[model samples]
Target: MTGLAGIVAAETRLSMVDGENGRLIYQGYLAKDLALNYSFEEVAYLLLYGKLPSKTELHGFQCKLAENRHLPAYLIRILNELPEDMEVMSVLRTAISSLGRSEFGWKPNIDQAIRLIAITPVIVAYRYRQQHNLPIIKPSDNLNHTANYLYMLTGEVPKDVHIRALTVYMILTMEHGMNASTFAARVVTSTHSDLASAIVGAIGAMKGPLHGGAPTEVIQLLDEIGSLENAELYIRGKLERGELLMGFGHRVYKTTDPRAEALRSITSELIGEDAWLDLAYHVEKTAIQLLDEFKPGRRLYTNVEFYAAAVLKAVEMPAELFTPTFTVSRTVGWTAHVIEQADNNKIFRPQSEYVGEIPS
Candidate 1:
């Protein structure tokens, strides 16, 4: 099944990507609705625990996440010894693999999942701060998962709007149906390997540019456009020259991307508050109009990375951290898939077709 397109490899109760209708469902709830109304911890809990947590359950989960946010001394030392110029994703892959002790062995469990989810942002922020020679900011108990990540990166409490925007992005991106990284994670788990090992594999897959690097390109597009005045001209020139627009369309989403829809709503609400988001909202409208005019039957619309570039930029996230941030959110999805794979284990062994003649 060349690249496995149109093949149903396994069953999952996690997320369903309805490309036909441009809808995403997370365990029967619309992902857009969840992103608009729920917290990151709530959605992560939903994915990992198979349901939303009660008030007491949520407090306990939040406490557990806060407790596990600190990096081990050995891991910190490892981070210090690594080269400053190493890619952040490479650093993350190394740090996660370092956690594969005997306790993270076969038969993955929720405790192991929680630990990885909690510490991923710390690993990224630690390495990033060290690379820039900035002081490392420890995680704050007062902040929730989304806000703490922002705090660690900048050492200041983030604005409520920035936190809300980032939380929506995180929840919307937390899961999708069998994406490359998620598939990599599940394949490794199917080998009866530890959850950490499976996640390491997923991180490796995400490290590839094809999967996790779209946001960087989208950022470049936004930077080039620069302001609302230039959006139409810049986008029209690209379309006229038959150049690829970075965030206009998607392979699976035939219409608008639901994730993009939710993010656009948030960005639109903050129109006068953030220049980048305002620019993004305008640029998206211009680009879509130009897309329909230039490539009339293509039906190209803004994908998640379009507004992702805007939101992250509005919150002052550096360009280099884009994919790593994606990794941080996607860890929840990866761990959830790992747990599901363990429940009904099967090694992923697909047959490859050969065109050459066989020996008789």
Candidate 2:
């Protein structure tokens, strides 16, 4: 028998990633179903509590998220000092890693979750503004997490479609169990590292091409193709050279990524009549056709990356901010997973098959 990589954990109820079939289920519900009906707050509660929250519970959750929107003064000062040209993710990585030093002897459970949640958007927005020489914009307590992030990123109140598109992105990107970043979180937690350390480690992992950063590349692919007329040729040429298409493949989904469908719809609706929508549609169709003709043996289908890039672009978000925006939406899931892991009290230690030279 061949040694197993254990890339697919068959037993854990942690997360379900069905790449061949293109399905992603968190807890028990389908990601597409959640994205269509639930707000970001509702999905966050569902992920954390194992079921959808009732109306009253959801209201309370929204309030809690809104209440925690402000960043601490110290973090603000640190944000101000960061170099203007630094990448947003780099700034976030450093700021979050340093947050551990500020933890006082003790704080209440809710307080800690609140602290993590509140400061996330601030950190994201602060770095973005600093990069452009714009002043930091505080999140409005009256808005939900998704809404407030848009408000902070772009000073105007986003329309309903914009909010919905972003909310769907959040629901889709949230916890995928034992993914590279989640495993990083669990690994750091296993070492008894602080929450901030675990999160910083996770952020670093997510910054990689094979992980959370793929959407930015997907957008770049679209830009290079430039128009629908060029998409098929461009993608086919790349596929011929054995280049990995950024948005089409997944490690776990054997069929189709459900989140892709949800995001595709949101992008279409958000753009309505924009030229990019037609371009994206043509690209999607062309990619499918080319893949069918060229890579018949492989199950490469569009994943969350495709529509995530489209929707972000539709909202006029710069390509550089894509992953940081991902972090803004996913912080809820990260915090929820961290809390869940802390509750279960397991040190995520796994045995490794030794392949290196063994000492006598």
Candidate 3:
């Protein structure tokens, strides 16, 4: 199949993407359910360990994560040595690969998974700071993952609204059925590669604009629109020009993405009665109307990136950090799938169709 669309590569017990019905399920629970009830650490535990953690289990898990949050001095030195213009994803990939603390024979273990999830935010924040010539703030052992991410991003304690909005976004994005990056992670892991190598490859795949990089573009789209009054005209003009609206469509979901719905609600709650939220909603309404009018019968509803832009903006996250933050949240999902793949080892060797003229 072209782009391997609709091909079931592997059976997973982790998460399901019901594209037709617009639902995302993680371990038999609706994604929204988990987002509302679970903390990022708790969600990480569920995905990595296959069940929600008990109170004590959760405490221990949190401590373990906290313990692993700090990067080694050598890695920090390497972060300091990165070129000022180096992309965040490249920095993250290099740092994660540098985190290969063991030999290639290392199996997929919870310790490896926890270490990956824990260090991702630190790497992102540290690299971002160094790129901008800001001092690297150490990770906090006291705050939870979401809070700590924001805290490190800005060297101050995060506001509750920022914490909650980002937490929900993290939960919703934690896992879904084999997206490009997750597939990349699983594919690397299938070869019995070390967890860090698999994760590094996944980070590389996620840096692509077609995959994890769209959220930042969504922000650029809105900033270009500038005002609600310009939204309809700007959108209609783009549609008439056959331009791709950055956040309007999805490859899998025919209906409104549940993650987008969750993010819209979360943004509303976090930035109540704000100009940004008002503009985003106006843009959404206008764009949906224009799309329905311009492209008939092809229902292009709002996907996660649409409101993910708003939510990240609401939390004052820089545009460049959009995909890296995604990498941070998705590390759990990647490692979980990696562990699962390792448990049931199978080398992913798909045959490609020879398109060009082959020598007979």
Clash numbers, per candidate:
0, 15, 0
Candidate 3 wrong stretches, greater than 4 Å: 103-105, 228-245, 271-274, 289-297, 355-360
After superposition, the stretches of candidate 1 with alpha carbons farther than 4 Å from their true spots are: 355-360
The best candidate by TM-score is 1
Output the TM-score of candidate 1.
0.96
TM-score of every model versus the real structure: 0.96, 0.86, 0.91
What is the alpha-carbon lDDT for the whole of candidate 2? Answer: 0.74
What lDDT does candidate 1 reach at residue 42?
94
Weakest ten-residue segment in model 3 by summed lDDT: 265-274
Ranking by lDDT: 1, 3, 2
**In lDDT terms, how accurate is model 1?**
0.93
Instruction: Give the runs in model 2 whose Cα sits over 4 Å from its true position.
Output: 1-4, 7-14, 101-111, 229-246, 350-360
Of the pair 1 and 3, which is ahead by lDDT?
A: 1
Model 3 C-alpha lDDT versus the unseen true structure: 0.87
